[model samples]
Target: MEKCNCRSILCTQMTSSGPHILPAVSSNSDSNLQKRYRCSLVEVIDVGVRYPPEWRKTLIMLLYAVLSTLLSSLVVVLVNNWVPAQEIVSPLPDLFPRSFGSSAWAFQLSEFCSFLLLTLWLIQWFLLRYKSIVGRRFFFILGTLHLYRTLTTYVTVLPVPSQYIICENKVSGGWEVILKQTFKLMSNGGFFLRRSPTFCGDYMYSGQAATLILTYMFIKTYSPDIFWVYQLFCWLLSVTGVVSIMFTHTHYTLDVIAAYFVTTRIFWWYHTLTNNQDIVVWKGICHGQETGNDAHG
Candidate 1:
């Protein structure tokens, strides 16, 4: 319960008289100088994140990621074939149909933003992994969120209207497809070869919105150094992405709204649960270690 006043850069020093940020250094320090990246919010919830040697947590995260990916893909395949509520066209026509036409520009913008954020995330993750800055553990928690998002997509089968459904023309017949189909087959009782192409009718939740928001959530939670820059950009991306979903008629209005709520709950609950219960991350803990000056910008 005591405030951490130590100058060790690995720890967060948030309290009265401290600078607006964690690992706060004097303004005199050169702008190019790398300060340690420590987030106070994550600290309170998960201790294991502060240590890189916690391979157990990383492994568990990987397992979860694999399962989530398979399940999510299966859901995509299945939902594409399932029928949407025919009577329910223009779910929230007032809030949605924001864009004039299916320019595909909005959707493309959202996809590009997600891709850009993903690339940055990968770079940061690589840096953390290289520095042993609990990168894998961070990735694991992130994977958990996606997994939850994926599994929950099937909770309801509300489909997008025929007019709004954008065909995901990309045909992926690779190792991933094989794996997802295998799980799909197993999860069901040997139902194979769904004839309908897996693109339309995939509604009830917007994966695009979830990806952008979750990406923002992770960066906001884990990386505090670029708080202002990243947070603003991420929020913008989230808004644009949600709006794009509506504009492109790619998803029903509730799908995008539900995604935001679901992703927020998943992120909040996971961190809170870990923080509240030491026993949960017991095996994931590693000895307290000091982080070096090499931090992300």
Candidate 2:
């Protein structure tokens, strides 16, 4: 009986100890799993994080503007030097009358103006951070004036028939006939203000009328004596057209339209590299306004 009691006691002790060992092993496994989970979470957070700065983006835009201007100036200079002046044909005389001053002067003046405008644009791009609203407005005006002058050359050279009295015919029908009549009346001082309108508005309405008038007055080679009395008037009108383009806000409609895409691309590249959130919204608004105007126009 004593032996049997001893054996039973040993078996009971072994069974109880075995149950305790299993619980300890389970607890250790749970602790290790928690440590691994915490480590994995930390790694995931670190992988998803991102950091960037705003000043770098602004520098990039400034650099782009500078490089582009330099390259364009170099190309223009090379072309001017390499090509003979006689080889260049002024598109104005062939389309209108052959009476305008030497085509060479027009070509040289155009190149000079292009260089001046590009220099101004570079200055504006670099000084963008310091420019006030008024400064920006002034540059905008200058850019518009420059663009108008450039486009005027192209428009004058366009193959379309002139709207001046020289090109008029006896249609006697269609709205074109009425338009020609109205233009003639306006040119001869029949419109408002008692005298002929010498504004760009009038000149543009007559469609290349300014070119015709200038060619008639200043072209020494083919001009008749009748054009001499109005020489002063023609000069005044030409100067007025150029100055009006500089000061008037009305002509900037097209400039703003073009500037939208250019400025937005610049701002976007700047903001992207700099990570600036403040000016991004404002730039977006301005860009939107330009786009809206372009679409409407």
Clashing pairs in 2: 53-274, 54-274
- Deviation from truth (RMSD, Å), model 1: 15.8
Candidate 1 lDDT over residue span 1-297, tens digit each: 223334432335445677345454444655444333333333334546443365665676677766665676666665555545446444445345654545556666766667777677666666554333345445565566556655666666654544534444443577576556646544542111222323555565666677777777766766776568876776777677667667766677777888888778877887786567875555345322222223321
Q: What is the TM-score of each candidate against the true structure?
A: 0.58, 0.22
Model 1 C-alpha lDDT versus the unseen true structure: 0.58
Q: Considering summed lDDT, which 10 consecutive residues are worst modelled in model 1?
A: 189-198
- Report the C-alpha lDDT of model 2 over 1-297, residue by residue, as the tens digit: 112122112211124345221111222355544332211111223465443434455455445533433332222222222322222431222311333212223323333333333343345345544334323332333233323433442343222212221222323556565455545544442211222112222121221222222222222212345756444444454444333322322222233334334433443464354457767788999999999999999
Candidate 2, which ten residues in sequence have the lowest lDDT sum? 4-13
